[model samples]
Target: MTAKVTLSFTDETIEDARRYAERDGMSLSAWIDQAAREKALRELFNAHADVVRRAGHDRLEKHALDDAREVEMVRSEFRGRRAAQR
Candidate 1:
């Protein structure tokens, strides 16, 4: 079930969205709906992630700062390896 809502956009933003819709071979309304849905989904996921992190903070044993740095180092190393292989 869907309810219709009216939204107002600045002229420039509207024009940009219309151009993007044309480029993607979609109607302006369809493109806007798709973008809106994706943004809403992302926000919902982020909210859920925050809630989960808060709930498990004490149960999680790893140090947050060290874990983040390690993850970044691993990601950088992996990227370098991949680039070298490529």
Candidate 2:
């Protein structure tokens, strides 16, 4: 469901926005809607950017630990092989 919104803008601004809307092959209302949606998304992302960063950091740390464990396991296997060949 969508509600109609009425906004007032300077004539010059409205003209510029109309031109942009035509250039993008969209209606003026659609252009404004997209702009507002994008602005809202940006604000939401900014608000949780730190939380996102921390989640990413935690994932990288887990991957690093898992990789280290795998490498050590391979090294141990090779050491055992060398011992058997001795």
Candidate 3:
């Protein structure tokens, strides 16, 4: 299911996002949605890392780095597709 909602942002931010969306060959909504999803995933990963640290895992930092790499891989894949289209 999909729902539409209104959002407001500073003019500078709106312009920046529009430029990024255009550069990525995506709609503004899609660019914002991908950013929001990445933010949510990062938050969840941080919370999990904290829990692991509390559980006496000394590799929490490494796990966080791995998570970051995963996100970057996804972004690279999207960019690759856009490049291929050109």
Highest TM-score against the true fold, candidate: 3
Residue range 4-86, candidate 2, lDDT tens digits: 87799999999999999888777787678766765775676455555646677755654654677756865675555435433
Off by over 4 Å in 1: 1-4, 57-86
Clashing pairs in 3: none
Question: Comparing 1 and 3 by lDDT, which wins?
Answer: 3
RMSD of each: 10.7, 20.6, 4.5
Which candidate tops lDDT?
3
C-alpha TM-scores of all predictions: 0.59, 0.55, 0.70
How many clashes would you count in candidate 1?
Answer: 0
Q: What order do candidates take by TM-score, descending? A: 3, 1, 2
Candidate 2, lDDT over the whole model: 0.68
Count of clashing pairs, candidate 2: 0
Q: After superposition, how far is residue 56 of candidate 1 from its true place, in Å?
A: 2.7
In model 3, state the lDDT of residue 52. Answer: 79
Stretches of model 3 off by over 4 angstroms after superposition: 60-86
